[model samples]
Target: MSSRLKRGIRRLCSTLSIPLLGCAPAERWEIPHFEPWVPEEFHPASIVPETKTVIVIGMPVSLPAVETSPSIWYHEEYRTVNTLLDINAYRIAAFLNAKGYPSVALPRDGYGHISVLIERPVAFFSHRHAAFLAGLGTFGVNNVLLTPRFGPRVRFTSVFTAAEIPPDPVLEDPLCIRCMRCARICPVHALPGNDYPDGLTDKRACASRSEELLRHYVSPCGFCIKVCPVGDDRKLYDRETMEIYDERKKEFNRLHRAWRHVRNYGGGERAPGMINKTPPG
Candidate 1:
């Protein structure tokens, strides 16, 4: 692809409300690092044989909203972001196709539902891996991609095309600081507190919690992302302090109260003991 067309694709992402975009050669999937880690069946070229480039786009899940996770507020925000990702990716693919480049957009989450994840947590495709290969981020101890722009609080989608767009450089430095906050704060003890591969999340436990939360209209427990201290977003939102996550802290009572109020109104009413009412610290 010409530099001008690549720039246009980026501008298109920005216009569609996507703030992060990157490209990677499809063959990056077979490199020494990813070759043994991700199976051949999952590779971009295997899925789309004409693929030459994998385009990734991401949108930040507002930290303030993520802080209220397991509540209706964060649940809606998550859905909205996923929807936009799918839409933006489809448009980008369409743009490439118009230029005579065979292109296809992949769904943000390939699973049918949270229940499906409980039985089998793996997705057909992995956007987190795609994001890392595209230079948008690196894997965290929590087993999610951690970007400098939004830490683990970002959602990603991908587009595959025959057009060989210039690929972004692979990030050489790690973004995760390994504070272990994600491991410590997990309510279900999903994260094992070790770096990626070795510390892969206990998907069954994590998915079970999400399945239960879905019954109450709030799913996808995001405590790991919420507690992560990476990202420029922390500074922008003035959330540099970890103490704010502790509800017992008197100073943050007002913030806690607001989060509680949001939780109460939407979703099925929490019975006497359906789920923990308090947000995980």
Candidate 2:
């Protein structure tokens, strides 16, 4: 792609538009790193034979909102980010198509429902993997891609285009601190605490938890990302202290109280004490 065309694509994914974004060469799939883990059918070229580049766009889930995991507030934010990622990918693909390149947008989440994941955890495409190859981020211990700006709190979608846009370099430095917070905080013990590719998530257990949460309109159960200390977002939001997530810390009760308030309504009921303790009357 011409430098001008690349600039135009960047403009489309700018903060004023689609937020975090990057590009990867379709051939990255055959690299030794991915060749062993990702199957051939999952490659961009496999899905779109004409694909020469893959554009990955991301939208972040707010830290404060995600802090209220399994709550309607975070649920809505997750949905909003996923929606924005998909919409922006579609627009970017359309832009490429208009430029005389055949392009196709991939869905943010390919599964029809959380139930499907319980049985078949893999998706038609993996945006997190695409994001990594695109130099958007590196893989975290959580098995999620961690962008410097948003950690694992961002949702991503991809656009495949026949145009050979120059690909961004993959990040060499690893992002995961390996604090083990994600594995420890997993309510279902889905995370095995091993570094990614080695300690993949227990998809069935995680999906089962998600399925239960979805019944309550709070499907994602974002405990892992919520507790993650990565991302400039923590600094931006003045939530640098991880202790704020510890409910026993009386000093952060006010924040906890606010989260509890959001969980109180607009979602299916949970069992007694299933969420935050009743706020002071």
- Work out the TM-score per prediction: 0.95, 0.94
Q: List the pairs of residues colliding in candidate 2.
A: none
Best by TM-score: 1
lDDT of 2 by residue, 1-281 (tens): 66688899888677446678788999999898688778999999999899999888888899878887778888888888888777878888898889898999999898998878888999999988999999999888889999999888888889999998888999999989999888887887899998889898999998998887787787678888888888999889987777664445543444565666677676735634656542221
Whole-model Cα lDDT of every candidate shown, in order: 0.86, 0.82
lDDT at position 197, candidate 1 = 83
Cα distance off (Å), candidate 2, residue 180: 0.9
TM-score of 2: 0.94
Candidate 1 residue lDDT tens string, 153-233: 999999999998988998989989999989988888999899888888999999998888888887768989999999999
RMSD of each: 1.7, 2.7
Cα-based lDDT at residue 70, candidate 2: 70
